[model samples]
Target: MSGTSAGAPEPEGALEPEGAPAPESAPGPRRRRVPRRERERQILDVAVQVFAKRGYHGASVDEIAESAGISKPMVYLYLDSKEGLFLACLRREADRLVGAFQGAATASGASPELRLHAGLLAFFAFVSEHRDSWVVLHRQASELSEAIAAAVAEARRAVMAEVADLVRAGIAEGGPATQLTDEDADFVTHALVGAADSLTDWMARHPDQSPEGVTLRLMNMVWVGMGRVLEGEAWKPVTG
Candidate 1:
């Protein structure tokens, strides 16, 4: 009648007329393609959260992938395994911390003391800014697999070595009065690292304290004792 008869079938395999544009198919869901570096960073960020919350043994690839809005296969493809992912997080955080320390330690033409002050400030600032990273690097990594522990330990040792070097320079520049035997420097370096690590927890709790304040307090505590030792003062217990 007026229009095509009801239920009339169109011709099979109708084709577009020559010189006419074909009808476009409906669009499918768009696949968001993240760059490899950016995707890896996203995965690592989620992984750190999972690891921090669950610990190494409790953290799962599925959870990490789901949290990252990626597939488990994608996580494995990017990081190989859970341990690999944890190690990646450790390396990244450790590198960041060591780099911060090094940059602050050497960023100025200031004296060794000032450089050390800068380094401590950088360290506390890093801890304040990246508490998750600190937990991952400081706590979780140590309790994970042996391979992970070794990797974290190596990073720690590297930072410690750098600190020891700074101490050595300070001693050398302090003239004969501040000179330290290699053994003594090594001892002091270990002690200093230990003290900083312990204080980092305190700093986390005491958010009101400025990094500069913490650094200055630590410097006062360390340098005062160190100055005495540098002048060859030794403490001995009184015998009964």
Candidate 2:
């Protein structure tokens, strides 16, 4: 990662174009100059779509620039190259995901269970709405150069760290979760994140399941067991 991106490993990114300020464009003789930041955002927006649809190797600077209704030179100027553009996409989606979870989970006055529920809900909601971004984040990260792969891995680390913090907070709050130690929290973090990741496929199949609904079900499966087991209801082996 050190030598990537013209000597810089990676950079943080922009909104996912839901309500991003529209780029300035004109069909008239006089064209307004788009601000550099807005222009860069426009490029990245199109780039994410292209990379998701065409993948890392198949997508190209020419097509991305054209699709954004801009010139290739401007793309290079803003993002450096295709790899740079991909890295920005990866980082942006990662930020959007982590941001969603943190914002929901940290809402003032919310209990730990509610916070975790909100966080998990946000995650499923994100995957549902931003399928293309998820494609790039989930599927396309492994098929490129080493630097890009490392950056993708870092994105995963960021998500893992957020879940780890949530687990620690849940442990701090007195509850059935209180029976759990930091080590237990660590294990829970692994379980929760892994389950959520794998469940994206399950979610794809069952589109009828709302994010809130899915979150509630996961809570029942996990949090309920935490409570039940703390009440001396641990599972025991059957004697032969």
Candidate 3:
């Protein structure tokens, strides 16, 4: 037989022998090596910035991985997909904000107003410090997947509940002037959240505004407004 003759053919089912060990396939995207915890954190950090800047859908896993100084396959190994990455980012930032606020509240033995002050100050400080994170949570995350939206909503509800509890305590101490029923507490809590959210949005837009300046302005508006409202006073626009 000539040396150039074709090699002997293997028996049938040679590629994958029955009840025999199959040759290991090369790694797929999911098989890439990465430190799961570290990679997940890095991906979340980069994803928040990317998603904040580009919005969720506009941003891609490749960009996030590149931003994190890794390959997309590595990112896939840590985070199953883009949606998973986004949810991870949302959860982290939400936990951070909630934990900070809760800590401020728990640590303070001050009055309700003081507690509110501490919490709000902590909140503004948090949002200012983590602008990208806040943007991811407040804007991009909310607008993306429903899972993300629900997470954001739940965080909001938690903050609102805390505010409602504070309001109830305020009503009890301040008597009729600051008194609030269940309905009033609900309305005020959401309104306060809305107001803080709006103010944060405005702060994000106006980066030139100092934190102290922003805090002072909000304090005057919020604390004074609450005091006035509890005293049977409110601001209303007059019709032309």
Candidate 4:
């Protein structure tokens, strides 16, 4: 919601009269002064929308400039280029989403089941609310150049680290997850990430489903899956 003046008002006098010397505007729309942090937010917000709609390759700095209602050079001044803008958007959303789940997990004070549910629910909620941002980060960022891929890897590493920490906690609590060794913990962490990523892609394709529905379904799946695994059940592993 916060960004460049939400597009300039109809050039003041342009709408008032075709010929008349239009009355001066009331010092113009309140220039919402975007400070450094807020300016970066605004840029990322615009970038998410543009990249989500057009994808990384299809999107242009010129289009992002137009969409953000800023000069092309200004977009460059803030984000450097298309790749920079896209990565900024990815980093911002990934950081927020990861932090949200981490906080939710620690603060829930519920059993591991409830904490896990709350964390996954929060994750889906973020993706639901910030669909554009989610898309840019989850989709476009993956296909970017090597430099951008490195940025994506860093963000992903942070998220995976949090997941691993939670997994360790779950194991310490002696739940079904407790059987996981360090290697198993890493595998489970990556599996959770892969599951969430797949769910995001699925929900994106099926916008008709409510966020609550998607969240609940994933919660049930994870809960049931972990419960089954804890019961000493195992599925066949793929062999090369």
Tell me the TM-score of each prediction against the true structure: 0.83, 0.83, 0.77, 0.75
lDDT of each residue in 76-187, candidate 4, tens digit only? 6656566666666766777788888888877888576667767777888899888887877777777778876886788889878877777666666665435657787687
Which of the predicted structures, 1 or 3, would earn the higher lDDT when compared with the native? Answer: 1
Give the winner by lDDT: 1
**Candidate 2 lDDT (Cα, 0 to 1):** 0.76
Q: Compared to the true structure, candidate 1 yields what TM-score?
A: 0.83
| lDDT comparing candidate 1 with the true structure | 0.77
Go through the candidates in order and give each one's C-alpha lDDT: 0.77, 0.76, 0.72, 0.70
C-alpha root-mean-square deviation, candidate 1: 15.4
lDDT of 1 by residue, 1-240 (tens): 122211224454433223322222346865545555666678788888888888888889988887887777766665667777888888878888999999989995567788888888899999888888888988777766888889788999988988888778777876875657888789878888899999988887888998889889989888778878777788899999
Clashes of each: 0, 0, 0, 0
Q: Which residue pairs overlap in candidate 4's backbone?
A: none
lDDT of 2 at 5: 30
Cα RMSD of all models vs. native, in order, equals: 15.4, 5.8, 13.3, 8.5
Misplaced by over 4 Å in model 1 are 1-28, 177-179
For model 2, state the Cα shift of residue 240 in Å.
0.8
Root-mean-square deviation of Cα positions for candidate 3 versus the true structure, in angstroms = 13.3
Q: Candidate 4: lDDT over CA atoms?
A: 0.70
Task: Identify the runs in model 4 with alpha carbons over 4 angstroms from their true place.
Answer: 1-34, 175-179, 231-240
Report the C-alpha displacement of residue 117, candidate 2, in angstroms.
0.3
